[model samples]
Structure formats: C-alpha cells, structure tokens
Target: MSSPASPTIPIDGPTMDALMALMRLIAAGVTDDDAINDALGGVLGADSDSPQPAGTSPVSSAALGRSPTGETPSVSPFDAVVPLPADVPDVTDTDDGGSVPTEATNTDGQPMGLSPLEFAVLRQNSHVVTGLLKAGASVDYIGGFSCTALCKCCYSFHKNVDLIRILLAAGANPDATTNNDTHSASCLIISVVKNNVEAVKALLEYGADVSYEWKGSNALAMALDFKKLDIAQLFENFEYRKAQKNRWERYQNQRRRDAEDREAKLDALRSRSAAPTGESPTPQPVDGRSTPTGRDETRSPSHAAGGGTGSPRSVRETAQLTENLGAMDWLVPLSDIEWGQQISAGAHGQVFRVTLKSTGDIVALKRFPCHDARSREGFRREVELLTKFRHENIVMFKGAVIDADVSAMLTELCTESLFDRLERTSAPIPWPVRLRWARDIAKGMTYLHTRTPAVVHRDLKSMNVLLDGSGTVKLCDFGIARLREHTFVMTQHIAGSPSWMAPEVLRGDDFGPASDVYSFGVVLWELLMRQVPWPNKNMAQLVGLVGFAGSTLELPDRAPEGCPPQFIDIIRSCFAKPEDRPSFRSLREQLDSLLVDVD
Candidate 1:
C-alpha cells in the first residue's frame, strides 16, 4: 500500500513569524507608543516614516512577500508562520503583498472577515468599541459567521453588557440573528440561554423581537428551561407593556388626527361666513360679550374700568385687561379672585382661602413671593403637574395667576389636614377610619406612581394629606414632588420634613418612589398613633437621630391596638432598605385585603 499523503498547513511560515512577534510584544506589556511603533516597524518591514494602511495588520506586508520599498520577498530568518488546521483556508495574496484571509473578507472589503465593531466586542474592549463607532464602523455589520456585533456580544461567554449597550446605542440591530444547521438564534435568545438578565433587558428596551425562536424554543421558553422565573416574567411583562404602549400610541394618533380634521372644518366654515355680503355683518366682541358700537351707546362703569376705546385716561387699564385675557388657558385673572383670610404662610409664599368672583367657588390660593425666581419656578412646576392629575384622591388644580407681581396657583379647598385632625381631637381615631385613610393615601400614591414618567411625592406627611367635606382624603402640597425619570435627581441639600423623610433622603442620597413609601410608613404611624412622629425632637435632632445615629421608630409594647398584625408588619417593611420596601401597588393590595377582613 502507498504511504498516506501528509496534511497541508493553512498558515504559512512568514505570517506565523509576524504573529509570534505581535504575541511576544503583547506578553511583554510594552504598550508605550514609541516602543510599539518601533517594534512593529522592525517586524513588518516598514520604516518609521512609512504610512500605515487603514485596517491592515502591522506585519501583513512582510507576511506576503514584499519589503518596505516594494521589493520582492527576500526571506528573512525570523519569518516563521504557525500552522493552522488543514480545514482553514490560506490567506489570499493581495496586490500590495498583504496576505489577508480570503474567508475573512466580506463583500464590503473588510479584512479579517470582521468589522472594527465586531473585533472590539470580541475583545470586550468598550473603549475600542467607542473608538470604532466614532470612526464610522457599521454597528450592524455582519461578520464571517453571519452574526452581528450585538449578537456576538450576547453569545459571548464573558457577557460584556456595556459593549453590547454601546453597540445598541450606535444603532445595532437587536433582533439580528445567526443561522446554523440547527436553527436561527437572535441576540435576545442567545442572552436568555446564557441567563443574562441585564443583556436581555437591554435588548428588550431596544425593541427586540420577543417572539423570535430558536428551534421552536422562544426566549421565554429558554428562560423557563433554565429555571429563570424572573427572566421569564420579565419577558412576559415586557411584551405586555409593549403591546399596551402600541395601543395607546395608536389611540392618541387617531384622536390627534380627528381633532385636526374638526379644526380644519371649523376654519373653512368661518372663512365662508366672513366672505363679503350686501349688508355689513354685526361685529362680535372678542370676549364673546355684547359691546356698544357706532357711537350710539354710552359706556358702562365696567367698560370705563376696562379703558373704553376713546379714553387716554386708562391706557394702563387697557393693557392690563388685554394681558389678563390673553394669558395661558389655565391662568385665573386677578380680577376674578376675591382674596379671603390667609390659611397659612411659609418662607416662599402664603396660602389663602379665595373665592372666584365669577362663580363664587371657594378655593385655596397659594401665592409665591415676587422677585424669587426659584419659588416662582417651583410654583409653575406644581401648577403644570397638578393640572395633569384628575384623581379623586388627588387635590384638584383649578387655575393659576402668573403675573410678575402675583404668581399663584388655585386648587380645590379641603376642610382639614390629617395633621390638624389628629392634633385637634383628643380621642383616639377609630381603627376603621385609620384604615380608610391609609387606603386612600395609598390609592392616591399608586395613581401618582402609575402616571407616565411617574411622580414622587418627596414630601409625604400627615400635614400634606387633606380631608374634603365628605371626609375623602386627598394628597396635596406638591412643591417638592419630582417627576421620576430614568436617572435619579441629586440635591445639594436635604429636602422634606425630617420626621417624615426617608433615611436615604435625610442622608442626602437619591430619592425614588421607595423613599415616598418610607415617608408613607411614617404617616401611617402618625395615623395609627394619632400623634406627630418624634414630636419631642426638633428637625435637627430628628435628622441626627434617624439619619446618622441609625435610629428608627419603635412600636410601643401595646401599640397600634385594634389594628391587624399585617398592617404593622407593612409599616416595618417600609423602614427597611429601599430595595426591600413594598411597591405602592403591593401596599394597595395589602391595604385592600385588610379592609376586606375588617368588613
């Protein structure tokens, strides 16, 4: 029998030598710019002054068969290429004598079969990935394996989620998949298989296709297979939320279109009616009230007060009237407000019981001090936010006055605050009433938290909770409330009352919905005890004790009598770490269940 032929190596000798030199440089930790340049120059047959080609390896020229001056190869003793598997194809020789792998070259002419983005992700170098992106590397470039940069990062065992995020933010396709003999696997599916929750979340937030499957196994199924209940729940919740958001967007778009069409039709009708006619049409007053014209009528006292047309004696009055009428839709003119006794006064402004002159409606008017920009801004923000609220448990926003000298917000008046109710009555509040109040506050908070972008009532206290005429609780005083965003808002100084503030807020840490929950616990304690929390201590003392001394409220041996043990437990849970606090939704459910038991 004839002897079997020897197996041929894929990589050649000179290429192997250059690769070894590069490896040696990496091992020596010689990352200095001058040192790397000089070392690469020597190995790659390039002088210091030679211009390096873009995306080409340092030693590619020498690996093929050329010198720095374009001379034909005179083999050096140092060129010893390592042998790859026989299945690996030989590097293609180029006109410039650079031997790049033929299989690695894509249709876009990318060498090594991978874009800079792919190489950066494979190396798990976020810095490199950023640099490549800044240099215009395609985020969705397909590599030799037909996998995108995002897909490769997801499939990577290292799980460099930061690199994946960089790729995604650069517009990488989250739903891009890799195909094999078995099935197609998307980035999300790969992440699920790897049990990478964060990576899966990132992909989902980027609108990844959740319904994608690999061999009939979807991401949710894969998560379940791996016993990742949290991941499965996340996937399910994401899908549900996405569908709801889509429906809401469609409904909003339809409403907007309908409103535009109606406006257009009304405009057309007005234009036709305004066209020329034989008789002049009666002029209607801009204010929608009948006005005397054509010099045939006398001016009324109200007209004189508002500066009738021919009067130079009332120019200022006319300007003022025009300003009041042309103000924002939500503005309540000063002329319409009949100020009553002052309800309260603070450093920034005063709250007064005011009646509307036009409708005789009683409301609470909060006036922000003039020349104080920050206070005015806070007042404006409160007005803007409260106008969006329409919940029974939330105080109703009536209107606002935004004059330079008088900036105020008007809201529905409540009979009494919870704090005043607790203080004025010596008798213990009934357990049922306390439970009802707690339920009401939780419902209000749940509504606030469920709103778009959510709302954090940073200042939650018995003083801020009001009782309407029918004893219905309504949350008020949103001066310091924050609209929750993706990132936490940092404060230079602490906000909120010390006794009712969360420990984190007292310590000047970032406050979130959980912080509000903590405050709600303190408020609940107040309701149950019918007394102010730490009434004996001042604000400074309270902050020192609760924030720095690590002291928390303690229930007396016979405290909160007639209340269920679970209610007390819920209060205690709120004082725990923020992460451990029950959400407003959970608290609502718990309170609801307690109410059922009471009934």
Candidate 2:
C-alpha cells in the first residue's frame, strides 16, 4: 500500500498528469500528507493551487467525497451536489418501486461536488439512483473519467439491482463500458466478478453479451476467476439467444430464396413461350445454368435473372467464398445436397444431417459462414485435418461443399451423440458395450495424441462423442481443436464448456494433449456415475472453485456400485496435473485390458 499522499504535491510532470497521478495515489489509500510529501521529497513544491482538469475528481472525492485539501467535509452527502431542475416534479415512486427518501452515504461520510446522479451512482445509493431518475437526472449523462453513470454503479461495492433495472429501463446502454490506460470492464463483467447476481441479471435482461471478451476480461473469464457459478449459469441465456438468431437468419435467407426462385421460374417460362410457338410447348428440362462456371453454375435464381433496369436482387443473394475449399476431388455439389434436420447451431457454425441427392448417402454436415477470416480458416482446417485423420474410432470425413453462402464439410453420420444416448436410454448398459466404448474412446484419443503434430481435441465432452450404429465411440467436433506442434500451446480464448474444462485451460494457461486427458477423466467419471459431470450448471462457481482453487473432482473413496478397482484409478489418474497424467496410449492399453474379457 502507498503511504498517504500530501495535500499539496509538486507539479512533477504535466499538471493534468500530475493531478491524475496524485488522485490515483490518494484513491489507492494514501492518506497522511507529511508522509506523502516526504515520499515525494524534492517533487513536492510549495505550490498547492494546480487547477484540476474538468471531468476529473480530486483523490478520494469521487466516492469517499474527501476534499482536495485533505480535510473531511463537515456537511452531509447531499450538501456536496446541485439541486434538482425546476421543470422536474417532486420525486415519486416512478423510477423504482419507491424513491430514495434519503440518499445513502458513501463508506466514509465525507462530501464533495458532483451531480446528483454521479454522487448517487458512485456511492451506490439505490434510493438516490431511483429518485434522481424520477427527478429527471438523465442516466444517459457521462460522468467523471468519461464513464457512463451506469458504469459508476458497477464500480461500487453495493450493487443495487433495482437501480440498475431503472437505469437500463430509462435507456442506459447495457453494453456501456469503461476503460483507462490499464484495466477495462463492463457493467456485466464488474457485476459478475463482484458476485452481485441481481445486477448481472438486470444486465443480461438488457442484452449484455457476458461471454463476449472485450479487451481481456469477459464475464465468463471473470466468473471463472471469481468462482461465481450463478452468474455463469446465466450464460445459457446468451447461448440460447445466439442459436435463435442463427435460426432466424436462416429462415429469412430461405424465405428470400423461395420468393426469388418463384419469380425467376415464372419469368423463364414466359421467355421460353415468347418465341412465338403456335401452341404452348411441352414442359422440358431447360438447362439450369444460365450463368455457368461449372462448380458455381446453379448458384441461385439470381444467376437466371435477366438484365433489367429494376432488378429483383440488386446484388447476389449468396456471398461467394474468398478462400477456395481444399480437396476438390471430394467435393459435393451444393445443388445435390438434400438438407435434413439441423442438429446444432452456434455463433459461427451449424450442423445438419444431410442426404446426398446423387448417391442417396446419409452424412453429417457442418456449415460455416463464408465471410469471417477465422471461419474460412476453420473450414480449410476441417478438410485438411479430417481427411488425414483416418481411424475407426474417429468420424470419417466423407466430402465437402463450397457453397456460395456457406462452406460445409460432410462426415459419416453416427447413430447419436454419447450425451443423448445416456440421457434417453432407460435400460442399464451392458458391461460388454460399456467396456468397448471405453476402449474405443481411449483408442481414438491415443490416435490423436500420438500423431507427429498431435491433434488436441479441445472440446472432449460426451456431447462431442458420437456412438455409431454398432455402438462404437467416434470422437467428433474439431471446431476448436488444435494441432499441437510442440509439447503445449497457449490459447487466448476459452474454448470448451466449463463442465469439462481443465484448471490450466480455465486459467488461460498453456494447454496440451494433457488437457484432453483431463476432459477424458470427466467422461470416465460420467461413465461410472452415469451422470453428467458438474451438471450443477453453475459454471462461474464451478470454474473458480475447480479451475483455480485446487478443488478436485473426487473419485469415489470406494469402487462404484458395479465396478473394478482399476476403473476408479484410471479416472483419478486422468484428473492429475498435466505433466503427471498418463499418455492416451497408456490409457488405451489399460482400457483394452479391461475389454479383453468381452473379446
């Protein structure tokens, strides 16, 4: 902690910078003037009358309301601020349920000058927040340090959710954030890190993307670091909204295509008959490629559109991919795809069970938008990696399509994901099949981990593990997977769900094949318990507690109801620290030994 600063410090640098530095020192808990003067030494000149720049506050005055001269204000909190506007009526129960009858004082009762809204928000006075709103104090106004008034509320120790809702409802931007030369934070991030559940709820209700990483701190990272699971559970709402948005956009795109197709077809029929035939010609298969580039021939109805002053679609409906998809030999025509039920959707991608119109082969297709640079790279990686990844336990890459709108990769369809199978099945799984699945997963992981540049399946939850018709485990979802060229790679973003996230990964540290082993342990635990690992749905708390706090997922003290002693040992070993954890090959051999009886 800094020694207490002097009331009058020398103008060591630029006046504003010096003032800012002085104020910062005071804010950081420096209080004794002579000690601060002694600390400053020659820098502490006699001049005490430096003008503070507008929109900046003296040290501790913003919240604690201490005077610039280091003397505590003798007046009450309200005495430091201006009165309400004349046009504004008496404060009523309008903003929240009731008015702030008396403004709540700050931690220390010292007073200083700031607007009513600024004073109330900085001190976390709920009644004052509401009353000021009712008294026409604009929540939209910018305050000290160029921060939005709502941001000040977030900085306070007390999170008054009622006032938060009032501010948001009164048109305060939920996404408004504040940043200085050092730290950056939003209302949601602050609320989450503070473990103020109500404030987080209000922010989320107003459309805050808590998972969104702005600067370095995001609500998800904050939740994990702070151990706030209730806040993390709220992240589900954001994901649901994102999925809904993807579905809605698809619906709109399909509707637009349907309308354009009808118009183009009708125009074509008219043009065909306009050739002055004596009677109506018999219906025939008109060549579909009006504007032909063999691969992009049947792009959309826009290709068939005639040159006219008023064109139906001014621009092309589908955007062409900038990066040509790799491996044209395995290419499938977009026109030949009979899109089936969509199985999953995410921010940048979607998955569907598709049937080939040419070969009538059922395949699982994952779609990525053609636009973003990252998505394009991911599309290319999916092709290059999956084609090389030849293993019975891994999903087989069948073909890919470089559609005008989306880049899609097709893989052999499986019966169902392991997560779904576990949830829907009523009967207890036979030991033979269970052992086989355990062995298959271990084998697949071994194949991935032992490669020249090992592929780390960053997301290794049961949901990404598919069970084929023969009940074989096929590890899937390589969207966030990486090729580990070395022993480990550091990742910038949080990739997998918190339920299976390893401690180092959650802490934003270096990840390796061992990260997958940690997730593998969770799967083994799920298999033994027949329950979802950390299904508590409290990500923030679980991440903080388990990820950084050294809380281990305890293997049952004894063997599970059915099982062998080795099974529990396997799960426990997988959960060990990365360096200490067994390799996938070792794990596979162990699993194979268990499955020897079935074979």
Candidate 3:
C-alpha cells in the first residue's frame, strides 16, 4: 500500500525500460513505478514543472484553459478550443438514451487534435498504445480543450484491463472531470456495461468517488440505469439500501445455486465411495480373461475410455488397432472416395470435393476411423501442428467430430488445385501473381521447416497446392512429414508422390529440407508450363530424365507468355546440387524483387 503523503513519482529509467518492454509482454500487467522509484533512490520524484521529455510535444497551455502549472483550463470542456461548427453538434455530452455517443466536432467540422494513437489507446488497444508510450508519447496531456486521458477512456467505454491499468499506472487521474465537469462518474458505469468489473474495482480502489454526482446522477444511479446491480451495490451497505438489497438477492441466489451444486457433487462422491470396495466392483472378466481387480479397475472415466477428456487434435488422426472390423462400415465409407476427382488428401486423413454442397457452402471433411492406428496417430499429430499455426495464407482447420467409429476433421474447402487452376483458366496468371504465390508458398514452408522439432514436408509439389476461390495458394498434404529427430524405426517405405519425389528420396537418404526444395523446382516448372511437367513422358521416363547431370528441360512454345527469366533461374538453382541451392529465404527475397518490378 502507498502512503498518502508520498509524492507522485515520474517513471524512472529502469521503470521506463520495463514499461517499454511491456508492449512485448502482454501479460506483464502494469509496471510498478513506486517500486522502481524506491529502488532508484527517489530519482522519479514528481516533476510538476518538468518540460516535455524528448520525442514528445509539450502540452500547450493555450489550447487548454490552464497555465503550464497544471491548473483547471476552462469552465466548459470546449471553452479553450474554438466552438464546434453548427454542422457538428455536441452529441457526446447529450443525455439521449444510454447509447455511447460519438465525439462532437469543431465549427470547421474537423475533430480536435486526437491522433490515431490516442484513439487506439482510448479504444483499449493496450498493446499498440504501450508501444507508443514506450516510444516517449504523452498520455497525461489534456486534449480537446480540457479532456484528460481518463475522460477519453471513460467516453469510449473501453473494457481492456491492461489499457486501464496502463493509464492509471502512468498517472492518469481517475477523478478527472469532463468538459461539462461531470467528473466521469458515468465512466465507471460504462465499465459495468462492458462486463469489466475488474476495471470498475480498480477505479474505485484508486479513489474515484462513486458518491460524486452530476445533474442529480451519482455513480450508483448510473449503475442502476445500466442495470449493473452488482456494481451499484459496491458503493453502499448492500444489505440496507433498497437497490443494494435487490442486488444482494440476486448475488445470494447465485451463491446458493453454486453451493447447492458443490454439495450435490460432494454427495455423489460420498455415495460412490460408500457403495464401492466389495470385490472391488470390477467389470466382470470376459470369457477366459483375468481381471485386474481393486482400485486400479476403478480408474477415472477417461482412463477407461482410451482418449482423455479434452485431448488435442491434428490435421490428421489415426485409430487404435483394436476396434471391431465391422465398425469400419459405420465410419468413413470406402465408396465416398471419388478416385480421380479428389486430387489431394490431408496427411491426417481428410478428403475434399471441387463441387459445393447443397447449401452452396464448399466444405472438406477429414476422416478418422476408430481402431485405425494410422488415422488416430495422424489425428493427434495434425491437431498438435495446426493449432499452433496462424497465418493468412495457411489453411484453417474449422472443427472436428469425434464418434465411436469415426473422427472427421473439418477444414475450409478449396475448389481448385494450383495445377488445375493454372491449366484450366484461359487468362494467364500475371508475373506479379505468380511471384506472390511463390512467396506465399515459401513463407508457409519456412514456418513449417523452422518450427520447433522442425517439420519436413516430404511431398512438396503443385498437386498438393490448393487454390481457394480467391486463387491464393495454400500448401497441404503432410502425409510424409516427420518431426526432426523423431525416428519411426519402422521398415523403410516410399513416402512421397512418385512424380514429385527427389532423387535422394527414391534412393532413401533420410529425406531432408533440401529434398523439399528440389520438389519445389518441379512445381515451379509445372506452373510455368500451365500443365503437368513431362506430360507426354511417363513417371519412369521423368525419373530417367532427372538422372542426366547438367541436363536442362525447355518449356514448350505453348507456355505462358511474359514469364520472368528470374523465376526460371530460381527453379534451376533449386534443382542443382543440394549444397549449391539457395535457401528459401534467398528465393523469397528474389521473388519479392521480381514482384516489385512487375507491380
């Protein structure tokens, strides 16, 4: 607790550094200025006459009604400033229904000097505002004639506890009055509307007067008007006053219901305990089976059920190996597989259609069949991988369904594959568009390859790249992906699509990142030709074609016009000796330059 006589201290260097670092640490709450000042031997003692710090503009006393000495500026909030134009009314101060009113304007119809940063702070963007504050921005200075930071926060009805904490910790006066001298009692009321009880509690704890009134309206009355009974009761003896009494009725009812629930749970536990222990009440042993009777038999519900309650998921999942073979009929049907049309499948066992559903919403369903080892394992891995990722171009997992026989992963359905989109569309993709797609692909790959444990997408080719309705390319198919250092120890098997497989993968060289780059080269070639690479030749012929050193393939005359020479160069470089290939970062930079030139 702070002593009343201790002077308000300015932020110290260490405190300032912490406050600045707070922009990066969203959960750090607020920096302790007093503690930092105490540790620094009072260097942060309040400077009432201190000039504006470096990188900040001085508060112009003329704009405010007060002098430079921090005195009240004007009778009206707008007094020091020019009166608003006849067109821009003072609606912000109106008492019309409780809607949050927009800010009033000046006579010239221009809003006063509130910058976007100020608006962001007022709107509860604590993360962004903290960044501005750390950069030496001022929040204490009065604006719009005489409105303080607290007044702006109150007017906006911001609910961010972080923003509120930042303002208060930075010395914003909780009791500051508005231009109308309303003293911002209604601001606390607004917090209740936002369900920001913590902010209201913080304000009251900071000495904001709930008893203070304006136009016969006190904070308690404002709370009542907003129907925030819990907040209103906090101001007075909740049991004695009529409004408080009513508030307490609701609160007590809630508490009674909660207590009843707790007691019911306790009763259930007692009943179970009292009834158990006779022969351990284990499940009757199956024919010829020996039961493991005793406490171990009565494990938690999840332990007996296999998958725990609220477990994670993956883009892919596998089934356990022990489920009934007949149960397969109840889950994903083999007939649903549209052999040739569904060109791509997720590593986790999902399939999609190019056609839309009856509701016209395109959809994709990931299949998880129970008791299938591959599906269950894939599901776990997919859930683990997808949830941690968030990027604009990456595919989003919508939801999933878990049932006795099947676990279907849901994701956004893309209508076209990158291969099909390039070949079928009469309009050739512009150089800029191609470059953008290449960059997007690189970024997605970079995120996967550099993630902790590092994911290597063994299948990296055009067919695995899906195009949404907007033509944005998203990489899919993680079937061959493996976490670095996590050896499967299973028999060696061919993992990637044969056509796109690198030479090393066919020879089984423990597929690595460079192999993915090699496949990317084939994909680039396909994109340029707007057709499958080596269409006339079979897979065996293509493999044979790649064996020749220093061999280069030329695009047919029908290839898209105006393709960049640099893009072709990149593809060639990626397919060169693994050690000689440039990194994806270098490729992205080169693509970015090409995009800039074309744009």
Candidate 4:
C-alpha cells in the first residue's frame, strides 16, 4: 500500500550515465573487483588505484558509528561520488523543514547518482556487491547519497533479501536514516512500510533499534496496523532479546559505578594513610581484651601462627566475640565483614575472600595470629607498606582489624596467583598476556625500589605475584620486605625461598635491590619457559646448587613458541653479578621495547 522513503537521482548527466552503466555491469554478474575498480577509475579519470583491506569484528548496537571496522580508512567513504549540486537553493515547507538542514541533494532535492556501489545495491546485484566489499569497499559509504545504500536497497524491485544481508554482513548500518528532514526515517521503518519480510528480519537480526519509531509509529505498530502477521510474529523474540540485553547492560553499569565509588573511598583512605600523622601503631582490642605484650609475657609468634589453644577459628567467630567499635579510614568495624571460603593457608596467615555487609563489596581478609608483639610486627609492617604503596600492580589496602583475639588485614582480592595459573592450565598462556604480566611485575618492583627508603621485596617469586580478573599482575606478601634506612645495602635475617632467593642471600652476604633482581630473573624464566626452576632438585639440593656451586640457570636450547627471544638476555642480565645486574627500571624498559609491536 505504501513505498519506502525513496530519494530521487538526477535524470540526465555524465555522472548519472556512468552510474547507470556500472549498475548494469553488476546486474550482468560482473564479480571481479580489479576489473570493477579499473572500469570505475576510467570513468572518474582517477590517476591511481586504492585498495582497502576488509575488517572483522563482533556486531552489537554498542558497536557504533557508520564505519566501525577499526581499520584506518584509506580514503573517505564519499570518495566514489561527491560535490553534488551546491549552488541550487533547496525549497522547504515551513513546518517539517523549518530549521533542521539536510545533506547534499541535486536540483530536484535528490542525491546525485554517482556511487557505483549504491547503484549496484539498488539493482539487487548481491554477488557483485559482496565481491566489492571483500575487495575493501566500505559498506556504509555515503557517496551517492540516495540517502544511504541501505535505505535505497529497501525499494529494490524484487526479493533483494540476499542483497540486504550481504550489505549488513559487510558492516552496513542497519539503523541508517534518509537525509531528508520530512522523510528522516530508519531503514527498518523503510523496509517495514514496503512489507519486505526478509529485509525486516535481516535488519532486526543485525541489531537494528527495534523500538525506533518513524513519525511516532514504531515498526511493531505499523506491522499490526497493516495486518502483516509474519512481521508481527517476529516481535516476541525481538522483545525478549532486547529485555535480556537491557538487564545485562544495567548490571554492568551498576558494577562500574560501584567500583568507581569504592576506588574513590579507598583513594581517600590512602591519602589519609600517607599524612604526617598516620594510623596509630598501637593495637586496639575490642570486647575488653588486654593488648598484646612481648613474647616473654604472652604466647609465642609461632604458637599464634599455628593452632593455639582457645583461639578463634574464623573471622566470623572473631567478629562475634568483639564489642562495638567505630569505623574510620585506618580502622573498620569487625562486624562488617562476611567471611567466605578460605583461599589460601600459609605458615604466616590465612586469607579469605570476604564481602562487606554494609557496601556488598568483596575483599581479601588476611588473618594473622598476631596475639603477641613478635607476631603483630608482621601485621604492622605489611599494613604500613600497603598504605605507602598504591600502584596498579600493587595490592590495594582497604583497612585492618587488630583485635586482641585475632589480628586480620584487608586488601583487594585477585583471581589467582601466577604460579597457580601456570600450573593448572594445560594449554600454554598467550604471549601477549605473559609478556604483559612480566612488564607489570617489573613495574611494581621498580616502584618499590624507587621509593624514598628504597624498600626491597625480599620474596619476589611467581607465587608472590597475582593475576587480577583482567590478567593484570599485582604484587603482594610484603611480610619479609625490608626498608633500607641509612644505607641501601642491608643483611636480611629472614631468608627468602630457596628457589627464588639470590646466592648472596643464601650465603648471608650484604644484599640490596640486586637480590630482588636475581629473584625476578627466576620469575622471568618461569614466564618464558612455563617450567619450574630447578625442577630436578630438592630444597636442600637447590640451596647447594644455586648458592655454593657457582652455577647459573641456562636458556632453553630452543625458545618457547610465540615468546620473545629478547627475554632470555633479560634473564641473563638479571642473573649477573650484583653490580652488572640490570635495575628493575632497566628491566621494565627492555620488556616494554620488546612488547611494542608484539600485541
């Protein structure tokens, strides 16, 4: 009963004649791209040939714009046809076209028929257009401006369903609108008005805005009014999919906002922690419990770390035993945490993924048995270090609980440790991901070494580094880390793990940041090789081999597939003598240079 918004084409002109000839060539089934380009070049008298490579991406309404291919457009989409009648004064009625202007039009207020692709689409040359698209022709090219190629295809004489699909698959805008102010309607409405069943389906499938209305009447309303049973039937699936999509989008937006708010609060706390008058080092006990004294007067640090008689088992029980306490930047209420499954258990402490009852935010709860002065020192040191360091690659501190019954600290939860990820997955990790992890670890270590006191992460192993949800590396476990006071070099009494420890540390030599570099080298080797360091040796054997044997780790005979070969030298540089070893800053620079073109 009705037709689509059909914009006119100039009736007579050399440009129109050439456009007609191109359309006929495509209609005659000319599928060769080079031949078409040569023919088009001859007609336009162009001096050179331009070829664009087609792009591939997932389609969604969020995938916005006319050309969302992500490739650098070799030339403008309007290159095929342009410079339509600019001298003519367009006539407009006072109501519909009052102030809103429109795009280029000919003397009859129609677009010039100059674009070969648009003309080919109008002629329903599906195969010819597909070939041109694969050969790098832009799908939403706005050259001929019969408003868009999609709008023009809606009125193609026959069942041009395949033609519509070809254009959409090549990244055509399904929701494209005509340029005329009065007829500014979406391609969906144009197809709906023409009762083009297949065109409507194709548009909806390609994520056309279903709720879009033309002149206050939506596609569904128009279909029902016209008694198009087939088109009306499609609305059920459309509405359901749209509802689910909207729900997911809302959830995602809320999560993003919550994360922003939580990060803002944490930043405020971090700023407070860094002030000249920072958190009180003294432990405040709840439930009228006495403050922990030295090991001579109370339980030993080892006894607290292990199972102590009449000790609280979980954070929930610990919170239940506590009295009411006010919340602050440094101190949070013990009752706020909802204890979760235990993530890890170490000789020093137990960590759990706990949720905050007040904000519904999940965080890691590290409960150390700091029942005495000796045990509580680890909690104090870790808390102070966490507050001072707040980099992307470092774990973010939330708050701490220093109850006399149980001492626990809170930090951001991560997905898993690097060691666990590498050991559990049978398939090899992607090079880009592993490369990025190496860079992130280096960045965190560099941040520590560059501080005012030049803190050293004595335990810089794969297990100490963590991977977040996005695969970003976050360094943790600073219990054994040392802050160099008067001098950069100091002797560590707390020995690091044998596998990742430097030879000097094992031999009790004067150590500094170079010791950490040696440990980082072993981690780099793990990332590159995906094999355990000194796998054939035991703890005692590893200590002797790496410490007293004067032996160095060797690169694999062949590099791991997809891994950069330059990292082998980086590892070697890390294993060099104290003076010759590269700084963390230097190591980060080397990895950065190698990953420049890798991704």
Q: Rate the local accuracy (lDDT) of all candidates.
A: 0.64, 0.61, 0.52, 0.65
lDDT of each residue in 281-398, candidate 2, tens digit only: 4443232323323444223321212323222231232222322332357877577778799987765478899999789999989888756566676677667778899999999999
lDDT (10s digit) by residue, model 4, range 1-599: 11222234322244344444555565455767766775554444321222213552211112111332333444422224422323323223312233212233455665443345654564455655765576556777555444556665664331567777888888888887765233467788777777878888899899886566677666766676687767766754455344334435545666788789989998996786563555555443534345556522222122223334444343333333222222336655566778899999886799999998778989999998765555566667787788778899998888876554557889899859999888667786888888888989999999999998899888899988988888889999998688952112112224467678787664445458999999999998888877788775444334334544345667886667787778788898888888899999999998898888588
lDDT of 4: 0.65
Can you tell me which runs of candidate 2 are displaced by over 4 Å? 1-325, 346-348, 485-493, 597-599
In model 4, which runs have C-alpha deviations exceeding 4 angstroms? 1-328, 485-494
All candidates: TM-score:
0.46, 0.49, 0.40, 0.45
Candidate with the larger TM-score of 1 and 2:
2
lDDT of 3 by residue, 268-338 (tens): 96687564446554354322234454624222111213433323322112222112111222232222323
What TM-score would you give candidate 1 relative to the actual structure?
0.46
Say which prediction, candidate 3 or candidate 4, comes out ahead on TM-score: 4
> Which pairs of residues have clashing backbones in candidate 1?
13-81, 16-81, 16-82, 17-80, 104-113
TM-score of 2: 0.49
Order candidates by lDDT, high to low. 4, 1, 2, 3
Clashing residue pairs, candidate 2? Answer: 4-30, 4-31, 4-32, 100-127, 228-541, 229-541
lDDT of 1 by residue, 1-599 (tens): 01111222233344444434543443343445555444444444532223446754433332322121233443321221222222334333322333434234334443332322343354455654565466444566443434555765676532567877888899877887754213678888878777788888899889886666677666765776688867877765664444334435545666788789989988996887785757777765544445456732222112212423434423333333334234357766677878799987765478899999889999999887644445555666677788889999999989876543456789899858998888778866777788889999999999999988899988899988999998899998897788863222222233577688786665445679999999999988887677678876554444434543345787655545678878888888889889999998999899999888876
Q: Score candidate 4 by TM-score against the native.
A: 0.45
Q: Name the 10 consecutive residues with the lowest summed lDDT in model 3.
A: 1-10
Off by over 4 Å in 3: 1-350, 353-362, 368-371, 485-493, 536-560
lDDT of candidate model 3 versus the reference? 0.52
Best by lDDT: 4
- lDDT of candidate 2 at residue 197, scale 0 to 100: 82
